[model samples]
Each structure stands twice: as C-alpha cells, then as structure tokens.
Target: MKKDLNGKITRGTQRTLDAFFDAMTALLQTKPFADISVNELCERAGYPRATFYNYFEDRDDLLTYCWIALSQRADSADLASVESSRRVDVALDAMADLLESNTAMLHAVLAHNPPDGPLFASLHRFIEHNARQLMLTCVDRDRFDLPADLIADHYANTLLLVLDWAYLRGHTLTRAQLHDYVHTLLRGVE
Candidate 1:
C-alpha cells in the first residue's frame, strides 16, 4: 500500500498492511521464514493473491517490509532536537519496548532462526542499514574524529551486538537493563 501525496498511509492501506503483517508474524511463530509461501500468506491475511502482489513482490519482500514498518513505528521519537549523546538511549528504549511487546513472535521466530540462520542475517542487515542512516542524521559529524560512514557503521555494529546479546542469548538482561547498557555504551561515543 503506497502512501498518498501527503505521505500518510491511508486507513484502508494501513488496514491492509496490518493484516499482512499480522499474518506474517503469526506464520513466523509456527514455521521458518523459508517455509512460508505467498499463497499461505494470502490465505492467512484473508486477502487474494493479487492483493498481496499489489503491496509486495514476494514473501521475502513482505518480511523485509514487516521489519521496516515495525522499526519505523519504533523510531517515532522526534530526535532532531534530542542531544546527540542521549538520542541512542531513547531509540534503544523504543526498540527494547518493541522487542518486549512482540515477545511471543520473537521467541518463536528465534527458535527456528538462530544467530547464524538466514532470518537473523536478514534482520541484521536491515537494522544495520537503517541504523547507519540514522547515525548519519542524528550525530554531528564534526564531533566524531572518524569518518562519518565509519562512525555510522561502528554505531550500527555496536547496536546489533547489544541487541544480539539481549535477545538471542538467553535474555540475560531485562529490557530496561538492555536499554541502560546500550545507553552507557553509546554515551562516550558522542
């Protein structure tokens, strides 16, 4: 569902998108991403195959869109005015909340897709790409000694590592602790 000229997702489009997302999330809970099919998604979403194709190219495309949409919702904070050192803290808090809220789906998904699995690799790449873009926008280039791209990559890698530890490695830290640890780790970088 593409946005209109106002760049807002219309209610109808949002409903359609949410249905697909819910279907994808539910499917991921029961099986590996590879096992999911476009027809199955359409069946679960209560939409026709043509309707599914209207919004996405394939199941993989739907999966990617799911993460992108979820992350965009998580990143709703207006960080332009936030202090550079504190922005990541806020962002991590949002992400941690997102993870916590989707615990059931995540637990199920993680069970089938370990750190070395394709699903994890796909998510990692997606987050890294978005995180790098975010870092460039939020951080002041003059403050970092490293090149902007390098700094962005460093931050993205660090965020991914912390996320892996928090979620994929037995949940040693609570969501709050995860947020705090990431906040501390990123504080000195700015």
Candidate 2:
C-alpha cells in the first residue's frame, strides 16, 4: 500500500493491497516467484500495472512483503510467550508447522534464488534478528562466552539449513520429528 503525501496508508490503499496479496498468493501457488511478473499479477488482481508500481518497487519487493507478513502473522501465534527448554520444543514444533504449512509459497520463494539472493539474505537476517530477540527473553546466559550475535547467527543458520535439508529430502521428516531434532541438537548448547 502506498502512503499518502502525509505518509499514512490511504483509506483505499488497504483494499488494493489486500487484493494484491491475494493475487500474489494465488500466483505463488501455481508458479515460482521468479516466474510471476507484474503484468500477470496486475491482470490477476484486476488492477492496472501502474497501480502495482504505486505500491511496490518490483515483484521481489512484493514477495518480500508477503514473507514478512507471514512471519508477522506467525508471531501473533504466541511463539515468544513460551519458556523453558520443554516449552521451547513445543514452540519450535508449532513454528515448524507454521513454516511448512505455507509449503507451496515457501518453496516458490526459496527454490529459484541463489544462496546469496535477496530472499535468502532476507530470511537469514530475519531468523538471526528474531533469534537475538528470543535470546533476550528466553536465554539466561546463552550458555557460552561467544558474542550473543554470533551464537544467534549460528543457531539461526543451523535452523534454516536443517529446514532446507528436510525439504530437499522430500520432506520425509515430520514437523514434530524436525522440531525434536533441532531441539535435541541445540540442547547441547546448555
């Protein structure tokens, strides 16, 4: 949604933005994010191509927005309210399920990108940042003397790689199974 001159989201922009989100999600179900174009998105949303520009700088930007929105919605599910290693495992199980639930969209968002692409970087940064925030609340002393950022980065990268590995292996791992593996591995930290 584009902001008005005053920089507030305009009254009608939310409607168009919702339409764009729905259209983009629909396209993501059938094609990779790279294959979806502004022309197709605009036609599907029944909005003009210029209208897409009024909001997003490009398709990548729109896809990033979608991913961010997914994380935001997942956040409201109370992942952070959990504590203790036991509850952490439960929280992770829920998180894994949430991520996997968006299977088609997640695959489309990740599959076409190189390791250094914006989407990968965005997800990496997002996971590391969120891990830092979670450590602030959930970790007492972080169990090691390393810089907090470094530990968080490593853990975040591990989580991401494990998830990627699971998907690469045809998703043979159940959500609970994945969560248990990650939790068991990280329990060594304490």
Best by TM-score: 1
> How accurate locally, in lDDT, is each candidate?
0.78, 0.65
Q: Candidate 1's error at 164, in angstroms? A: 1.2
Q: Which regions of candidate 2 fall more than 4 Å away from where they truly are? A: 1-11, 75-81, 104-137
Candidate 2 residue 126 C-alpha distance from true site, Å: 4.6
- Candidate 1 clashing pairs? none
Q: What lDDT tens digits, residue by residue, belong to model 1 across residues 157-177?
A: 777778878877765786667
lDDT of each residue in 1-190, candidate 2, tens digit only: 2434235655588678777888988886676566788999999989999899988888877766666556656633344466545545554554576677777766664556544665566666666566556544554444578776665555555566666567633567876678877776776665
Stretches off by above 4 angstroms in model 1 are: 1-6, 175-190
**Cα TM-score of candidate 1:** 0.86
- Compute the lDDT of residue 89 as modeled in candidate 2: 59
lDDT of 2 at 124: 62
Worst 10 residues of 1 by lDDT: 1-10
The alpha-carbon deviation from the true structure for residue 59 of candidate 2, after best TM-score superposition, in angstroms, is 0.9
